[model samples]
Structures are given as structure tokens and as C-alpha cells.
Target chain A: MKFKTLVRPLLVATAAVGATAVAQPAAKPSPEGVATAAQNVIIDRALLTAFKALPSRFEDAKNPITAEKVELGRMLYFDTRLSKNQDLSCNSCHDLNTFGVDNKPTSTGHKKQLGGRNSPTVYNAGGHTTQFWDGRAANLEEQAKGPILNPVEMAMPSADHVVATIKSIPGYVTAFQKSFPGEADPVTYDNLAKAIGAFERQLVTPSRFDKFLGGDDKALTQVEKAGLKTFLDQGCQTCHYGPALGGSLQKLGLVVPYQAKDQGRFDLTKKESDRMVFRVPTLRNVAKTGPWFHDGSITELQTAVKLMAQHQLGKQLTDTDAKQILAFLDSLTGELPKGYIAKPKLPPSGPKTPKPDPT
Target chain B: MKFKTLVRPLLVATAAVGATAVAQPAAKPSPEGVATAAQNVIIDRALLTAFKALPSRFEDAKNPITAEKVELGRMLYFDTRLSKNQDLSCNSCHDLNTFGVDNKPTSTGHKKQLGGRNSPTVYNAGGHTTQFWDGRAANLEEQAKGPILNPVEMAMPSADHVVATIKSIPGYVTAFQKSFPGEADPVTYDNLAKAIGAFERQLVTPSRFDKFLGGDDKALTQVEKAGLKTFLDQGCQTCHYGPALGGSLQKLGLVVPYQAKDQGRFDLTKKESDRMVFRVPTLRNVAKTGPWFHDGSITELQTAVKLMAQHQLGKQLTDTDAKQILAFLDSLTGELPKGYIAKPKLPPSGPKTPKPDPT
Candidate 1:
């Protein structure tokens, strides 16, 4: 269920962006092909200092990786029986196929309830400073536990209900046992989160930009290379840097203040400093994961680009500048690991498997 | 999207059924160990005449099968982007991983809307005479078109919307082109249904029963063989006689009228002869798919077994008979095709892709 193309130019806002003059950049020459000597040096140095190529997998400290656990996690990821309605699994929102998102402004949840925030892409998320927009959860494993219990999300009655559901499916019983050996009762809710996190860790997608970071000068095209220079020159790299290209914390409105229904980290910590402060999202698949921003209100990459520069960088990006960066962002689109994300065949429900509860 | 896995026994109801006398099934001697000479001959002859081993694949006459087409269909099968919510796909209801069923008494649809009927197993649906509970569609291809447009199912607004959605994905353009060569426009609504139907054809599950039908007598355990005898002797074979074990149409209340909100095939054709008649469902994965009956009113297999006898055959199944028959039914559990149903990597949505409409 994981190998979906995350390219989301089909997003409604993208069309709105595409309709603008910046949709097709009309630079004098391609950014890559015409970069000045000074620009090239800045591009090379900036990439070397702030970024590293994405790795194929991210390692979790607590839950060691194993083929068995990953396989089990894959099944759980696709099993809709996890939700109270039996219609949603982890994949329902963080869909592996669509670059790990449902591509909604805010994801629709149980009973079709909409969430308050847009879903972050699961791809390459293991490298995040913290999971979720507010960073309330410390890691992917901790984040995995939240949704099943969230009234608007997967909505399992309780952790016990989830554990009991897994216990009812005999295959899951054996899978849990195999995934977590040496335990007397292996199918606990915590272990379920661990398994899903383990599977998610394998979702790291390395785009061509990673190859450039790996010192492949020819990996990106001329226009893309120029776009990279513009990206760094504009100070977008301050918070957006690293193997994931933005696994750090930053204020949502850095140089300028922004308003929204959510107060970002302020909601979690209830601290003035944390207000509007969000864990900076990875730019890895940003093109495929729009409408952009915390609220997912901006669909057009140009608009998102302009807004970010204005609110966060305090600089107005020209049409050519926005177009160039959009080209560079396009370089972040990565190849889906063919077989790794292939949907696993979930076990048949056992005689004791729980019935879906619509109520 | 959650309404599934109404497996009563694995469910708390499964415990209730498991607690029944049939749970232990105490006959003076085991039905298997002490089968009479007359029972052996009848079981052998009836199986030979009425049942054939399940075929590896069911061929379609209108939509010729191909590797390319099936591959594309597999992607479409797992793609929730096909639905209006971008949260429901063909896999949402007929999941290939769980024996091709969501296992709901009634499947949940877009916005967590509920459907009226139980989701049938897609495992061997191709072998059936018609599709759906009422035989409204003539074959799997036609049947494949229903749920996407059903307001209560995947809830795609229109077939054109579905086609446009598929068209928005750039990879689908190449895929449809490759899958249907020489076509001016390959990504049509009809072709989408055909591609999906092509994939569904490969969902055949071959169990021990198929091996037994292939003339491997030893494949049947002593108890299973006894159950087969009981299955045939009780006249359950009349409508259930096919490679699918039950593809023929049958009256819902042959012996006595059964009451339900849904009036079976009468809703589809509005013909008096078709009243109370439904296409006999395949028993292929009956054990895996629960909340039995059209309305999914029953969850326990034992009760479903008992009800079929009383309502459809006008016979009372003793605890011993139902237990022995259930043991036989267990033999029908087949191996899922390892990689055939593996979720495909859907193409990325393209620039022209339509945005999801939550409303």
C-alpha cells in the first residue's frame, strides 16, 4: 500500500497556481544552464553544509527492524478493521500509494469527520524532529498510537478494544507472537504501534535531490540546479535542511505572524514561545503533498512559495523566483521502492475477530 | 470506510457459537471415523457430478485478459483516489488481502455512509453466473462499475468523474495506452471497469476442496468427507453445484418466507419470479466473510449454516451435522496468491488531475 506516486499537481489549488503567470517560468535561460559562477559556488556550499542525501531507511532506536515485524506492520497498515467503522486503517489517511497522504486539505476521519489539520506525508517522516504538525508526539511510534484512539480518526473504542481485536484474528495472534518473541502475551497495543512504526521507517524516499547531495553534479537538470541556488540564497534552508530537508522545528510565521484556527505547538505546550511554532515539514515530497501549509489552505506551489517567503522569510519572491523554486521542488519527487511498498496480503479474520461497529 | 469484518465467531458472537453444542459436536462416534459404506459412495458420486476443482483463472469474453491490463487493474483496485473522498477504492469493499471482502455485514462507504447489504467475497466472484446479490449485472466487468458510482459505496459522483480522476494520473495515461493499444482514448469509463474486471479474474483461491475435486481423495480429511456427504444429501448442492460451489440463483425463502428489509432480486428486476431470489453466493470464502445473508443479519457461521438449512432447504440441521459440515467448509480455506494481489504502485496524479471534493 505504500508505493503510490505522490505527485499531486491534480490538487485543485495546483490548477489555480498553474493559471498564474508564474505557472511556467519565463526566465531568460534555464536556472541550471545559466547559473553564474558565484551562484554555482553558493549552491554547492549550501547543499554540503545543510543537507544530506536521504537514506533508503530510517532506523528507530526503541523498536529494532526485522523482516517479520515489517511484514506484520504492512498488514496492519492496510487492515481497515483497525477503525471503529472498519473502514479506515493507517493507510486511509497516510496512504502509501499517494505519497502517504489522502491529499485532502484536512483528512476525513471516522464517520467522515474532518480533522483540524492536514495530514503530513508518511514518506520520509521517520527523520522528523517530531511527528504531527504540533509535534505533540515524540516519535512515529508514539504518533501511531494517537489516531486509533482519536474520536475523529480510526476511532477504536479503547486500547483494550484494539488489543482484543488483534487477539481475535488468530493470524495476527501468531504474527504478533512472531514479531515480538520472548513475550508471553505479544499482541499488546504498544507492540501494534511499534510494528506500524517499523514499517513506516522503511518509507524513506530518496529523490534526485538526494543524488545531488551525494555529489552527483549531473543528477539534477540545469533549471533544477539554478532553482537550488535560489532556494538557498533565499534562506529557505535555515529550518528546511537535513536528509529529509526539514526535520527541525520552526515558527510557522517566522519573520511575520500568521493566524489560523490551530495555534500550532501552542496548543500542545500552551507556552507563548510555542505559539505558531510547528516542526518544520520535510520538503521531500512537498509538490505531491499540497494544499500546503499547516492548514493545507494553499494548493498552488507558487502561492505557497510566495506565502512562505513573505511570512517566514520576510521577502517577496518574484514570479521567476517562485517558478525556479517550484522546479527545484520538482526534483524532490522520488522513485517509489517497487516491491517494498507493495500491499501485503492481510490475514483472514479469525472466528473470534471483532465485528465492525458502525455506531 | 470501516464497515467490515463482522466475523461473529472471532467476534464475541463467535464465542457464543463456539460455546454452542456444535462447538463440541458430540456424536456417538465421529462422523469422519465411522462413515457408512453408503455414505462414502454418495459423497464420492455427488462431488464428481456436481463439483469441479476451482480453476486458476476465469476467462472473460468481452474484456480479454492480459498481463498489462491486469497489472493496471490491480493498481486501480487499491487506489482510493477513484472515490469522491479519495478515501474509498475498490479495495475498500472487496479487499484482496482479506479474501476479497471487507467482511462487513454491510460495508461502510464515503463519509462513513452505510450500505444495506453484506459485501460478498470477490475471491471467486468471476465464476458466478452474475454479479451482486440480486444478479443485477451480467458479469464481473459490469459489476465492477457499480460500487464506484453507488452513492452509498465508493460514492464516485459519476463514471466520468472516475475516468477523469484516472486520467489525471500521468502514469495511467501510459498504462491505459499500453494496456489497450491502437485505441484513440484508452482511459474511458468502460475500460476502467474492464481493467478492474481483468484483475478480479485472477482472484481465484484454490483450496483443499479443489484438490479433492481434482480427484485427490486423501485431500479430504475423514470429517471433511462426511461433511461433503451431508452437504449433498441435504440438497444444498442443487443451487450450489459449480466450480464456485454456489453460482446458481436460489430463492431466499424456498421452504418458508424470510423477512428482511431488502427483498433480494426483486429490487433489481422487479419481476415476481425473481422476488425473494438472489444469486446463490459462492461458498469459497464463506467462513472468512461473515455477517452472512444479504442484509448481513447473521454473523455466526454455525447459525448461518443452520438458517440456510431451515429457510432454504426446509431441513433442521442438528448440532452434529452443522459441526461436521463446518469442518468440511474449513477445507475450503485456500492459499492467497502470493504476489498476484499485491497492491500495485499507482501512477502519480498529474497536473490535470481533479481535486478531491469532500462534499
Candidate 2:
């Protein structure tokens, strides 16, 4: 059987499970059509709510997008010599060509060792309320330095070491001076993170969904339009209605009764109310980024949609409703930048040493 | 006391440590300056060797420099969404602006966890006989995949998963088709590594040292010239006389008697003779790529030089000799490609969704 056919039945089975859980005395679906409509309403509301929680634009005012800073930050981002080991660079993860992700469930660092969490995309991170799923950092600048200093991340020892290291490179020193002049140390860690964050702020991809949201009726297909209706009627627009849909923080179990082993924000805030609270992810490129969630537990978008409906909306969804919602999610994919498809210039080859002369 | 004054005496004291380890049976101080003469020999040999390692300029290469491939790879290199946690990227460790390394003793990976060894510079890795400290992989293709699949490196579960993840990205599918056509699956893990490896091959750096090796006498300063003489006169070129300076594998304890926990190639090959054997790293941009060696035990260039003299060459290097050698090494720094610096375009901001909208 084709992949879609196999998936269709699985979706129905899961939806059936949801239907059985929500069967109550107040109302029962006596007809197949009524059951289908009820399921569609549940799925649409849950997804729309998640989508409505995203932000609209790049919010950082101080290091706003400038052609120069972004250009400089881009170079710094790809330069591998930034780590203690010259092996990895920013592109090792969050590959732009791959919708800003490396597709790894977890990342490896300096010595080819595994890390704790999945790498997030910087595509629309400028709209995030805070960085990281746990919300340990308040902004991109604060978020930028965390990995550079983390022993398992970039493994840079200290800010002074980073500054001294950058100063030695005449090209970097010049760039830093031009980017941030008059500062005692232009190449300091603060400036480095700011420069990177500024560059990240420009990674804005506008998808077909945006075109449709902006009132382009023809931008989406009939199925996708139906999916859009389902998405709104089920109350998904409540949380995921923003420009960069779902970049805010939220309690994961607010509508869902599920609990994850990871404490999420509770570890950072030490508050019971903050338990399982995670930064709501952007659904702009949701269809492309999977295995889903911070732990990457959910693999299929259809399964995730069904789970959300039964748990979050306390309603059951059918396979058709889930499929339509997924189609709408797929429409959110955007076009990459013009030059985003090119390879980087490698470092230079040095002088060759001569062979030893035999006496 | 001035910083120089305090450091000068301490340097002399350390010089004695080298003197005791490798003293010639009969030694005489030359009137012309023993250190200067020794420096020139090392520089001359290293320069000649580096020049010969370059591929013939007239060799017709199929995949010549292109705007598309390089730009695509560049974007992939800096994008951080590749990791499971969405926090780290290749640039997290191997930063180009920082001399193709982050200058950390070890790098961090997933959640601020420590990696095993120092990150090597990606610069001129194309010219190395083998990749990594242990010379594990035979070429860049093999080496590139090592990190992506390594539990501690990119931490990708499998190549198939990697392919599926990237295939979800439409723009990537287009780029992969252009880069590699007629394949059943163009965005497979092997192809991804190949694309990245192709980009890495272009990282060849041409330094001032290369100019000098190409017969440009004016490329180096007098102190640097003096250092080159000392490098060869003291037999520093015995093992380091190669295109990559020291990319060939060698035993670590060549001179001084010291034991290390790492068995080097022996661990990989299971051959007793390969114990403590490691690939001699290229000296290109050595000044920028530090804490030095397989274990990153040494922090200072002078200290590293002294240790190599006493252990590898079985000779004592004076302070002046060490200083001159460092100057010669520094000349290996080179400029990155023009327009290598770029601005990354971020994903667009969607409509703003409220933090706790219960719609």
C-alpha cells in the first residue's frame, strides 16, 4: 500500500480512540455525518488555538535588522573556528536548506558526544518570547552566549578568551570595530551574541499560508481551505493565531491531560504552576519540522492533531478532519532566501613545507 | 613591574627546562646568533613543503567554484535548527572568524555538556592524509558522516531519518536535485555529507607563508625569517616537513619520555604499533587554532613549542627560538573569501497570537 493509504487508516484508528474517550450521556453521534462534523470541529479548534499563539514580527529594537550587521553575523555564524574544535559550525544544525534544522533528535559537539535537547530553528525565532524550550534566557542576546560557554555546546572557556581569540584575527577585529565602534572591547562576548542575534533576526521566510492569511484566496487549495475552516472552528486559532504562530510560552497540559518526564520551565522557575510549561513552538514550518515536540516523541502531524483535540479541546476528531488540518499546516511552508542555497567559502590552504634533504 | 619585565624572567626559567631535556654533547653559541639561524631553516623547509601540496593549478575540476553550492552550504552551516534541542550548530564550535576554531579546550553539545577533545580547524582539512586526531577517517566524505551519525556529534538517529527530515523542506529538495540529479533519493544522508564535504574542500587557505614558499622573499618579516632558520637547524622539520605541516600520523612520545592515557590509533586499529599514534596537524593558521594537540593539554604557544622540542625533536629551544617560531606560525593566517560574509534571511513573522488566548 502507498504511504498515505497506510497513514489514513492509522489516523482513523487513533480518531476512534479519541471518540471512545469523549463518549458522554449529554450528546452522542447517532449518524456518520454528525460524527464527522463533530470530529472536524474538535480538530480545527485545537490546531487554530495553537497557531494563534505566535508573534507577528522581529521585536528587538536595539539591534534591528541592518544589512551590515546581518552580513557580518552570517559569516560569524558559519565560521567553524568559533568552537574549541574546528569541526562544527552553526550550519551543522539549523541548516537553512533543511528549513533551519539538522534533522537530528539531539546534537553532538566538540568530541562527537550527544547533547540533551533538540536544536530549534532560528527561522522565526526573532518572534519568540524567550529562547529555549525551558525559557532559561529572556532574549536572543542572552540565549546566544549560553551555548558558546556551555562545555557541551561550543565549549568556549571565558569571555576574555573569546575576545582575545577574535582579536588575533585581523579580519574579525576589523568587522567588530566596524560593527560596534568605540567600545573598549568590540569583540567581547556580548557583542558577539548581539551580532549573531541580529543576524538571526533577519531569517524571515514568508509562506503560502501568509499569502492566504493576507487575503489571497487562491493561495490555498480547496482541501487546505477546508482545513483552514476546520482549524478555526475547533478553536486552534486561540493559541496559534499570531504572525509567527506559537512563539509564546504556555503550559503544555493546559487543555491536555498528558504529563512529560521533563519538568520544562519548572526546573528554571521552581514553581509548581510552571511544571511542564514550554515555549510554544512556531508552526510556520510545522509540516517540515518533525519528529515533533521538545522530546521529539510525536512523529506524525496527524497523530499530534488528534491528541490535541481529545486532550486539549476535550473533543474527538476524525481522520478526515485531521488530514485537512495537516494540509493547512503544510501550506505554512515558505520560500527560502535567494542566496540561501549556496555553499560557504572554505578557509585558505597555507604554504607547503619542503621535504627533508637526505645527506 | 611592567608585564614584559615580569614575564621575561619567567620565560628564561622555562627555557632552562627545555635546556636540561635536550642538550647537545658539545654546544657553542654562534656569533651570528644561534636562534636566528635555526629559525630560517625551519621556515624555509615548511614553506617549500606547503607549496608542493597544492593541486596542480591547471588540473580541470568538474565541480568548480559556484555561487549556488557555496551559498547553500553556507546557509546550512549557520542554521541551528539541525540539532534535537534547536540550540547548537556547526558554528557553535568551528567558528571561521575565530580562526576556524572557538579556542575552547573542549566543545559543548546538547545541554551544556562537555565533549571529549579540542575541535580541530576545518581549514585545509582537504589536504590532510586523514581526518581527526586519531586519523580515523580516510577522507572528508567518511569524516563528514562520522559527526552526523556519532552519538556525541550531530547525534542523528539514522541517515534515512536525516533524508526524510530534509525532504520535507521544499527548497532543499530543489537544491538537492540541482546538486545531485538522477538519484532515487537526492537528499539522503550520504549526499548531505557529500555536499557539506564539497564545501569543506573549498576551505583551502592561502597564507603569506604560502607566498614566501611560492618564492616571494618579501612575504615574511625578518623575525619570521629568523624563526624559520631555527625551526630547521634544531631538527624541527624532521616530522613536521609536509604539505599539511604535520597531517601525517606519528607517535606522540618521539623524544621525551611521557605516557598518555589515549592509545590513539591503536584504539581504532587494535594494532600495538599504532598506540599513541596521531595525525600531525597542519600548521596553517596554527596561531589562531589552539589550545594545541590531541588532548589540548598546552595553552600557550611558547609552552607547546618547548614541549615539542624536548619530546618530539629531542632538542632544547631557546626563548628567542620559540618567539621566532611563533612569528613564522602567525604568518600562516589568511583572509577569507570575498563576500563570504552574508546576511541570513529569517522566517517571516506571522500574525500575533496572544500568550493565553482561550479562543
Model 1, span A1-359: residue lDDT tens: 01111121111111211222121112223333333322433243312434667777999679999999998988998999999989998888888888888888899889999998889999999888677887777688999999999999998989999998898888999999999999998999999999999988999888888888777887888777767766754556545665787755555644334445577766776544355667778898899988777787777778888766654544445666778788899999987766666668888888888887888
Give the residue spans of candidate 1 off by over 4 A: A1-359, B1-42
- TM-score of every model versus the real structure: 0.46, 0.43
How does model 2 score by TM-score? 0.43
User: Could you report the DockQ of all the candidates, in the order they appear?
Assistant: 0.01, 0.01
lDDT of 1 by residue, B1-359 (tens): 11121121111111211122121111123433334411443243312434667887999678899999999988988998888888888887887888888888889998889998888888889888667887777788889899989988888888888887888888998999999999999999899888989998988899998888776778888778777766654546545656888764555644323445576766765534345667788888788877688888776888888767654443456667787678788888898887877777778888888777778
Candidate 2 CAPRI-style tier:
incorrect
lDDT of each: 0.72, 0.59
Docking class of 1: incorrect
